[model samples]
Target: MNILVAHNYYQQIGGEEQVFLAECNLLESYGHSVYRYILNNDQIETTPPLELLGKTIWNWDVYQEMRSLIRQQNIQIVHFHNTFPLISPSAYYAAKAEGASVVQTFHNYRLLCPNALFLRDGKVCEDCLGKVIPWQGIQHNCYRGSKSASAAVVTMLTTHRLLQTWNRQVNAYIALTDFARDKFIQGGLPVGKVFVKPNFVDPDPGIGEGKGGYALFVGRLSVEKGIDVLLEAWAQLSTKIPLKIVGDGSLASEVNRATQQLRGIEWLGRRPMDEVYKLMQNAQFLIFPSKWYEGLPRTLIESFACGTPVIAANLGAMSSFVTPYETGLHFQLGKADDLVTQVEWAIAHPEQILQMRQNARTEFEIKYTSSESYQQLIKIYEKACIQ
Candidate 1:
């Protein structure tokens, strides 16, 4: 099958891009023809605000380019990973006009919330969930803390809603979790169009021994990731309990300060993928302290593939990802005290943690392998095409 896969890259490299690359590679590895269209958020730096807003609502150039690609390549499927603020809803219309089936993977809740996180003031905010206009998101300056930026997003969503673009143009919408799919439906995506498909770990970083004594935290060091709660919990933990931190983001300075002040905390900053997988393999377990409703973070699934159990906060899509005492333990969302308790339990119950390692690997083998994800994706594409 010939497919045109498109994605909008964030200024910072993240999991969504990883998935975009992986899925393209996956298709090629199986002998499918793959074409790619990429736009980067770095472009936002130079684009004027009004022009950006106009382009975001409908990128005429992108629409023409998409139509040409579909017609020339005879593209059977146009699978979109991300199209916000750049590629825009116009691309979907282009696909439909060219008679190419549209398959959109919603890595976040942009269709439901202007911020795409359903988060505000460091907590889950659903004021705009089911609203057609989502004026609440604009009122709260939800997108990058700028009312103008928020309004831009609101205008795009509102314009699309009024045009019925989301309902008629796209044939399939892939949500990373059932929770997310439900939320999108609640927010007005067609019920039959939305499907649940979790992200997978590629290249199979075989199960680890879980021999590393220190706990591990790998992700952006931002407040939304519950970094402050992690620091507070670490402060209360025994100095002998070591923590290895990886990745860099908005809270890099605060993480640096924490490493300096705390005895057992070691800040390794950002490491390459091999190094990260090695770290995951060696670590006893991974800590996912995120506060928002995630779109199935790669870190959590990667940890499971490594046979490393997680002590993740019980919230969002992650709440359903980790099964307590089975694959990993869950702590109360945003609660330093509860997180501390879960860590203490893992420390005390080495036997159960070992069992969890087995369970975690089994979970990966059963549901998160690259082959399984490919089959699921092809099924989704076939369904959309038939529709």
Candidate 2:
């Protein structure tokens, strides 16, 4: 199959960027010819605000380029990762115009929320859900705290909704989880067009022995991630279990401060993937305390690949992934006391943790391996072509 993958890269590299690269590599590894059309957020630095807003609605250059690429390559499927504020929905029309099926991966809830996170004021806010125009987002200045910027995104969404671009142009929408698929459906995506496919970890990290006594937390240190809840939970613990945090974000200073005041807390800021994986392999269990509706975090899958049981918040998609006392355990979202209790339980039941470790590895093998993901991708592509 000839595939043209399009993505708009963020200025700061993130899970979506990694997933985009991994999918491209996954396709090429299976002998599929893959071509890429990429736009970076760095371009926003130089682009005038009005021009950026104009391009967000429809970029003629991107449309012309995509048309040419599809025709020249005879692309069977044009898979899109992210197309906000740069590549635009125009690319989807361009692909369909050239007789290529369009498959868009819903990495985040951009179609439903201007911020794409459904997060506002440190909590999950779905004020725009099911609304044809996200007027609430514009009123709240949801995108980058700029009302004008939010208005631009709202305009794009409203324009596309009116044009039936989302409904008609895109053949398939790949959602990362069943929870996300449901949300997209509630937000007005066609039920038949939406499909659930979780992200996979390539070149499997292999199972870990669970030898390390300490627990691990691997993600950004931000409010929505429940970092504050994690800190409070650590403070409440009767038995101080060694905890290593691996990531950097807005709350770096707060995390750094916690390391000094809290016993058995180590802050390893922004390590490379190799180093992070090493930590995952050695840790007794991984902690995911996110408080929002995450689009199936890659970190959780990575932990499973390492055969590490997770102690995650019982909220959103995390609740679906972590089976209680099976693959891992779940704590009450944003409740430090519940988290502490779960931590103590995990500490007391070493044998159960061992069993969970094996189960986590088995889960990874069954659901998250690159081979399984590739097969799923092929089916989605086939579905798009048939549609």
Candidate 3:
């Protein structure tokens, strides 16, 4: 099949970028022709704010590009990863008008909420979840903590929604978790059109023996990531479990402060993939204490691939991944005390941790392997084609 994939990339390289690339590669590997139509957020620097906003609602250039690609490639399907503030929901119409089946992966809640995080003031804010306009999100300045910027995002959604773009244009929508699927449904997307398809790690990092005694935290350093919560938990833990933090973001200074205050925490800024895998191999378990609803954290699957257990918050996709005593343990969301207790439990039960590590690897092999994901994706594609 000839596939045309569309995405709007963030300035920073992240899990979504990786997923977009990996999916394209997977399709090409399976003897399918894949074409990408991507827009970078870095372009925001050059374009005027009003122009960008207007284009975000409906980029005629993107539509024309998609129409030409469909005719040139004879695209049977067009899969979209992200199209916020640039590529626009109009791309779906472009594909449809060109007689191509459209499938969109809901990596975030951008269509239903302006912030896309559905987060505000360090907690889950669903004030805009089911609203037609999501005016609350605009009022709260939820997108980038700037009302004007967030207003632009809300405007795009409201405009397209009033035009029935989401309801009529897209053929299928993929959500990474059942929780996310349910939320999108509640937010008025057709329930039957939405499907569950968790994100998978490609070129699996072979399982490793946890020989090192340290625990690991690999993600952006931000308040929403619960980095401070992780630090507070580690500070109170009676046992000295060494923590190696990988990745950098807005909370670097706060992470540094925590490192200074805590004895065993090691803040190892951003590292290469191989280095991160090594850290995962050595660590006792991965710590993921995110406060917001994650689309599906790449780190969790990476940890599982390394045969490493995770101690994550009992919220969002993390809760679905870290099934207590099955794959990994779950701590209370945003609670340092709960995290500390879970950490202590893992520390005291080294043998149990090892068993959980084995279970984690087993889970990855059964669910998140590249081969498994490829088959699932092909099935989704075939289903879309039949519809």
Candidate 4:
């Protein structure tokens, strides 16, 4: 199959960017001809605000280029990763115009909420979900903390919705988890068109020895990530279990401050992929304390691939993967006490933890391996092609 994979790269490289590249490589590895149409957020710096706003609604350049690419490449499927602010929904129309099946991955909730995170003021807020025009987001200046910017995104979402672009142009939507799939349905995506396909670790990092004594936390250090809750939980622990945090974000100073006062917590900031995988391979378990709905975090999958169980917040997609007394365990979201209790229990029961480690690795083999993901993706592509 000839596939044209499109994505608009964010300034800060993140999970979405990693998944986009990984999926492209996954397809090419299976002998599919893959072409890329990628744009970067750096272009926003030079672009006029008004022009950028207009482009967010519809980019004629992207449309023309995509249509040409589709026709020239004889692209069977056009899988889109991210198209906000620049590429827009115009690419979907271009693919349809050129008679190509459109498959969009719902990496985040951009269609339902202007900010795409459904997060506001350090908590989950769904004020814009199911709304035709995300007026609440515009009022709150949700996108980049600018009402004008928020208005631009709202306009784009509203415009496309009114034009039936999302409903008609895109043939299939890839939801990263069943939880995310249901959320998108509630947010107004076509029910039958939405399919759940979790992200997988490629090249099979393989099972780890799990010899490292410390627990690991590898993600952005932000308020929504429950960083404060994690710190408080660590402070209350009777037995100070070593905790290694590896990531940088808005709450770096807080992490730095906690590391100074807290004996067991160590902040490693951001590390390369190779270093991160090595850390995961050796770690006893990974900690995920996110408070908001997530579209299946890649870190959790990576942990599973490394034969490491996760002590995650019982919320959203994380809950689906981290089963109690199974692959891993979960604590009440944002409850420091609950987190500490779970941590203490996990630390005390070494045999149970060892069993969970085996279960985690089994979960990866059965569900998250690259081969399994490839087969699932092919089925989704075939469904879109038939449509």
Candidate 5:
């Protein structure tokens, strides 16, 4: 099948971008014809706001370009990764009008919430979850903490929503978790149109022997990531278990302060994927101290594939993946003391930890590898094509 993928990339590099590229490569690796129409937010630096907004609402240029591409290439399916602030929902209509099936991956809650995070004021705020106007998001300045920016997002959503673009244009929606799928359904998307498809790690970084004695934390150092909670827990630990933090973010200074005051804590700034996988292989366990409604964190899969068990906050998708005392242990979200207790327990039970590590790898082999993900993706694509 000839596939045309559309995506609007953020200025900063992150997981979403990685997944988009990985998926493209996976499809191509299977000898499928894949074409990408990608836009980057870095263009905002030179592009005018009004021009960007006009394109975002309905890029006539993208429509014409895509329509011609569809006709020229005889594209059968259109899969969209992200379309925010640019690329627009117009791509869906354009492709559909050109007689191509559309399948979109709900990487974030952009349709329901202006910020696309469903988060505000350092917590999960679903006040605008099912609202067409997302008035609460505008009032709360959800996007970039700016009312103007939030208003723009709300405008985009409301505009497309009233036109019935989401439901009519897109043939299928891929939700990263059942929780996310239900949320989209509540937000007025057709329940039957949405499918749960978790993100997977490609190339199968096979399970490795954990040699590093210290526990590892690999992610952004932000409020929603529960870095503060992780630090507090580390501080309270009676045992001197070394902790290695790999990733940089908004809370770097604060984390630096804690690292200075706390012993047995090492803050390693952002490292390449190869280095990260190596770190995962050597670590005793990965600490996923996230406090948000995360869309299937890729780190968890990477950890599992590396034979490293995780100790994550018991919330959102993490709760679904990290079964307590099985694949990994989970602690109450934002509870430092509980995290400390779980960490200590995990450290003490060496045999159980090893068994959990084995389970973690098995989980990866069964569900999170590229081969498994490819089969699932092909099934979805075939269904979309037939529809």
Candidate 6:
């Protein structure tokens, strides 16, 4: 199979970027001729506002370039990752116009919400879910907290919806989980076109010993991530159970402050993947305090691959992987005290936690291995070709 993968990279390297690279590698490893076309958000800095806005809605350059690439290279499938501000839906039209099947992964709620996170004012919001125009997003200045920026996103979404580009241009839409798929369906994507495909950890990190006595939290330290709850829980948690925080984000200063004020809290800002895996391998359990309806975070799957049980907030995708006393424990979403309770419970029940480690690893092997993911992806590509 000849495949062309398209993505718009974020400035700060994140999970979406990881998934894009991982999928491309997986396809190539299986003998598919994969070519990549990527645009970075760093380009946004120098681009004029009017030009960027026009490109965001529809990039003629991307459309022309993609058509030529797909046609000349005889690309069978075009798997899209993130095409928010720059690549736009132009890529979708280009792929289809060139007779190439289109497969877009719903990495976030960009189609439904201007911000793509279904988050605002530090809470989970659904104001724009089923709306035709999503004016609520612009009213609240949701995207980047600027009404102009939010309006740009809303215009992009509304323009496509008006054109029926989502249902017409794209053949297959990959939702990372059942929850996300349901949301996308509600957000007006065709039901049959949407498919669930969770993220997978490649080259398996192998099971860890859990010998490290500290609990670990690895993700963006931002509001929607429930960083406040995580920090507060750590502050109140027993000092006997140390907590190690990784990753940097908008709340880096806040996290650094917490590390200084709270006892037994270690702040390691953005370690390399090997080091993160090593930390996961030795941790007591992984802590995920996300408050939003996440699109199947890659870190959670990686934790499962590491055989490290997770103590996660009982929100959408967070609760899916963490089955109480099975894979890991679930804390009440946004409740610092409840998170502390779960952490304490894990500390008290060492034997139970050990069993959870095995279950987590088994779960990963059953559903999230590279081989399993590759097979599922191939099926999606086949379906996309005929859809």
Best candidate according to lDDT: 1
Candidate 6 per-residue C-alpha lDDT over 187-233 given as tens digits, one digit per residue, 9 for 90 to 100: 88899999988899988889999999999999998898999998888
- The CA lDDT of each predicted structure is 0.93, 0.92, 0.88, 0.91, 0.87, 0.92
Clashing pairs in 4: none
Candidate 4 residue-wise lDDT, 262-311, digit = tens: 78889999999888999998998898999889888899999999999999
Question: Taking the tens digit of each residue's C-alpha lDDT, what string does model 5 give over 167-230?
Answer: 8898889998888888899999998788888899987777878767889999988888988898
TM-score of each: 0.99, 0.98, 0.98, 0.98, 0.97, 0.99
Clashing pairs in 3: none
Off by over 4 Å in 5: none
The deviation in Å at residue 319 for candidate 1 is 1.1
RMSD of each candidate? 0.8, 1.2, 1.1, 1.1, 1.3, 0.8
The TM-score measured for candidate 4 stands at 0.98
The list of candidate 2 runs beyond 4 A from truth reads: none
Per-candidate clash tally: 0, 0, 0, 0, 1, 0
Q: Cα lDDT of model 6 overall? A: 0.92
- Give the CA lDDT, 0 to 100, for residue 16 in model 1: 94
Q: For model 1, how does the per-residue alpha-carbon lDDT over 1-387 read when each residue is reduced to its tens digit?
A: 999999999989998999999999999999999999999999999999889999999999999999998999999999999998899999999999999999999898899899998889999899998888999998999999999999999999999999999999999999999988888888888899999889998999999998889899999888789999999999988385889999999999998998889888999999998999999998988999999999999999999999999999998888899999999999999999999999999999999999999999999999999999999999999999987
What is candidate 2's lDDT per residue for 1-387, written digit by digit as tens? 999999999987889999999999999999999999999999999999999988999999999999998999999899999998799999999999999999999888999999998989878899999899889998999998999999999999999999989999999999999999999999998999999999999878888888988999998888889999888888776256888999989899999999999777899999989888889998989999998889978899999999999999998899899999998999987889999889899999999999999999999999998999999989999999998
